[model samples]
Target: MAKQHKIIHVDMDAFFASVEQRDHPEYQGKPLIVGGQPDSRGVVAACSYEARQFGIHSAMPCARAYRLCPQAIFVRPRFEAYREVSGQIRDIFWRYASEVEPLSLDEAYLDVSYTADYNGSATLIAKAIKRDILKETRLTASAGVSYNKFLAKIASDMDKPNGLYVIRPERGEKFVETLPVGKFHGIGPATEAKMKQLGIETGLDLRNKTLAQLTERFGKAGHYYFNIARAIDERPVRSSRTRKSLGKETTFAQDITSVTELTTKLLDLAEIVLESLAKQKLNARTVTVKVKYSDFQQITRAHTLDHSIALGDLREVIPMLLARTEAGKNPVRLVGLSLSGFDAGKSEDRQSQLDLAFSDPF
Candidate 1:
């Protein structure tokens, strides 16, 4: 058998909120939130562990978060500060592992399979990295070491807030058996519900389903589910992965009923997206419009052209896309626009782009 690869996943504990606390000593151990004001139409970007006790989490509406804990402290995000810390943390990752794959500002995967350090022990490297992060950044981080990305990422979350967990290669397959399908890394809430409807609640339940049965129900993703259920993921840790899409969305505090008003909002969003695209020197061929009704019904309509879409093109295309939705007949609670099918030659410029979260279901 081929040698198993060693991977370590590291995630900062309550990153943004922790940063706020670290900078402002008065905010320490308080119910701190980093996002919009309670009165604004903004959502919680990140909250301290103290805020989580009051049932506040990222993507929750700031107004609702206030209702949960009226005493919670809310502050606007300082991306510059976060980016600086993220860069520092990445520098530490390079000290131990040459192959680093950053998932976000606060989390990354490091492949140490070929490294001769620590007697080729990934667990020791993970521990040392965690120690270095705490010493250098003064922030706690959780680490998970395993043979593949799936298990490594999952192990990292099993023990949190300065945790270090390892899943041995021998126990990798058995470890997934008892986990709920919803707990799987890639399975979202919608997919979890679908899996439950099919009487697949845990990894064992998913593993019992034949490949044909899975593909018939889940299409292409069925193959992925099947392999993950068996803990047989073979995906390599790519140091350079291209981002697929970048866009912006806004959730309204009040529903919008006028198609004209909706069109105006789309234009504003398009301007921001197009500006980012231009700054990145990227071209997009597909435009997607998302509409969420007041009753929580969401729909997306997309149009693709052979040529890159310009602002002038979107001025004409936005109305046609809105016409396909029930914006006038029904109230729209959220509206978003995304540009995809980026020119293959260009990779995403992370520093120049900010992809906000769409309306969160939870």
Candidate 2:
């Protein structure tokens, strides 16, 4: 029999906003927002608990957030500071577990099934981690402990603002039965409505359906749903996840069919993508241009380079790549560009250098 994996998921509470407040105590209890300006086309990247009281959250349009509370404090993101803190937290995780999977700068999953430290108690390790994070950075982290990745991720969200919740194997089945279908990790609003239409509102309701019945309705996702509804997940907490690509896109306020107009828009997107690559200090060997017509028909054209393309060369390469697409032939609604094929070694080196630069020497 395979050993049950002990997993811990740690998610920072209002990470970006919390960092901002810690750095500037005056904003601690205020409704603070961090992201693009309210007057621009930016969206809320993260908001404090105070701002959440007004129904504002990450990814909401800044304009709407402003309308919700014009008095809220807004500021741009400081990625350097955030990355520095992320490194510090990851260091604490490393001391307890060798298998740590970072979901982002603010959250990660740690697998400590075989570690004998703390007498093999995942709960004790999680508590120690939260304590260390608070002592080192003056920021709070919430943790969820479970036997697998799926349950651990879900458990982390049960409480907020420096919370720690655990789902023991004995109660896992009963716990899942009462959970809403939408609350399951992969189920979104659209799937929830579909399940509701089928009279499956909760995990117990979902478990009532046979694998064949679910497969017939949800396709491949049905097989996944059937297992998770039973609180059985075999997925591992992968420690080496690679970033495959980076890209940027924009929706135009108006559609245009002229080639000249399309070129102008594509150029703007290329510049942004190149700037992102420069910031990461990486190079790419492939370029792709995506186009969506006014009718919402989307298509992409890609070009692979014999050599990696530099920032300055993109201005010339973008026009060449755009010519391969159907941008001017139809009214275009959106334009996007992407770059990939970075050398894995270089990317790792760049990340290490960045983490060190942001970390405190003391």
Candidate 3:
């Protein structure tokens, strides 16, 4: 039999909030929410394990979170502190696998099929990584070990907050069979509700559904659902998956219907996006502007530049793209600018050359 692919998924327990608690020992046992001010027009970024007990979660409105647990500490996000520890965790992952796919600053997938440590056992590697993270950063990381990405991802979530779980190849099918279809990765609340309506409540229930039926209902995602039900996922742990875009956006305290005001905000957002690209060592040719009106309708306009817009050029390009929107006529609640179509392995000068060949003539 061919050797199974060994994969490990690492997720930091309550990443942002945990970092704050680690740095400030006094906050060790308190419910903590890190995000905008409770009264601000923003959402929760991350909450501590304690805060989740109050039914708060990421992306919940901060004001609503406050209403749930009035005593919870609501601090503005400290991304710098979170990112520093993120680096610490990645360093530990690199020690074990040559191919590490970072899903975010706090979580990643590692392919260790041919690893030399622990005689090529992935479970041992996971334990080592969790131990290293605890020792170096004073943080806890949960790990899941399996033979492929799907099982590995599922395994990680089975145990929470600094626990480890494993899904063995021989038991993969049985493990998935008893699992709830909604618990499968990528099945969000909306889809879960749809599944419940279909009476496809468990993996066995999902497996019984014909491909034609699922495809008719869920489209392309049906194929994925069908495969994961059988413990037959083949997606590799990709190390070179390049990011498609980077952006920054903000919500105003009050909607404004002024073109000049919207342009100013996009310029600020463009500067932030440029700094992010520089930090990631990436260059992009496509510039896009996103506008959200007070009515909750949103639209995007993109302009492909002749060359990668240099930091100095974003100010001009952003306004040009913004002009394509109903800026002055629409009361705008949010504005964002993004850059995409990264040309990997190219320096800024070469990327500039490649993009200019296709830049918009207008």
Candidate 4:
């Protein structure tokens, strides 16, 4: 007999803005914007619930957000604090089940089918977890209990800001039929518009189309859409997975064309790569440098180190990589640095070296 599946989705409500309000008593009850500086060419990272009432949201231009809420308080983001809180939240999830898949800093899915205390039911477990978060973090969380990740994630959003919802296996298909297409995860604005054009505005409309029709229209994604339309998601909740590669890339605001300036940008990119590696406990044996010209043409140059590479080594190697470039070329528009071929053990050894290098040997 097939085992009854048990999954829970937990999402923090307005995570970034809520964190800001929690730390700053003065920012409470007033509209607050957290992102880039308003004076600079910055975008809104997040805004408080009050700011949402004024149509301020993430990815909106800071200038536009300011215009919408003239008296809004704007502050720079504290990512370190957010990371700390995220760790705490994940630790809380661990008490319930070890099979937790973190989607981001503020959301995760847990499979508790084989839990030590399965007698209580998934819904009860979710409610207990939410209450625990509020008690420990002084923050609110919304939880959804269901038989699969897709339905659980959708149910989690049904109730927001300290909400608890459940999707029973028997009612799953009916619940999905009434759901709007836009509400489905991975169907962003562009896909939603296309779905609307095909008269697929609701899950029911999506179910009406044959799988072949969906595949013809949406390609591989069409298959996923068809399954989701029927509320049948069999994907497992993955807890730990090996990372294939580590890299970072950025698009320039404007094209740049100078080796000296490009070198400077490479330094910054290397630092970002190093910090990410440090957090992930990874060290790379291969360093790849990416260059993009004004015309959007791109090329990559890579160097393999004899031993695991360090950030300082990357700083020294990047300029040499740039020097190998053909002398007579246009100014580069963007520069990126990537470290791949990570050795988990090498990362720990390198971290020890770093610690010793900075230590005061008396």
Q: Estimate the TM-score of every prediction.
A: 0.67, 0.66, 0.66, 0.66
The C-alpha lDDT values of all candidates are 0.85, 0.82, 0.82, 0.79
Candidate 4 stretches with Cα past 4 Å from truth are 241-362
List the pairs of residues colliding in candidate 2: none
lDDT of 1: 0.85
137 in model 1: Cα distance from truth in Å? 0.6
Best by lDDT: 1
Error of 4 at 320 (Å): 51
Off by over 4 Å in 2: 241-362
Tens digit of lDDT per residue, candidate 2, span 61-159? 999999999999999999987996786677567656647899999999998775555766888888988987886577899999998888888999999
For each candidate, how many residue pairs have backbone atoms clashing (under 3 Å)? 0, 0, 3, 1
Total clashes in model 4, counting residue pairs 3 or more apart in sequence or in different chains: 1
Indicate whether candidate 1 or candidate 2 has the larger lDDT.
Answer: 1
In candidate 3, which residue pairs clash?
Answer: 306-355, 306-356, 306-359
Q: Candidate 3 lDDT, tens digit per residue, 244-327? A: 666655667679998888888788777867775664456799988888888867899998877887867876777787778888
Ten-residue segment with the worst summed lDDT in candidate 4?
353-362
lDDT string for model 4 (1-362, tens) is 45667899999988888888976788899999999877768999888889999998899999888888889999999997788568657756765653789999999998766554435377777877887677546679999888889999998999887899998888889998999999998689999999999999899999999999999989999999999999989899998754545555554655776677777778887786677567545668898888867664667888989888887788788888887764127767556677888775565654554343211100
Which residue segments of model 3 deviate by more than 4 Å?
241-362
C-alpha lDDT (0 to 100) for residue 28 of candidate 1: 99
* CA displacement after TM-score superposition, residue 271 of candidate 4 (Å): 42
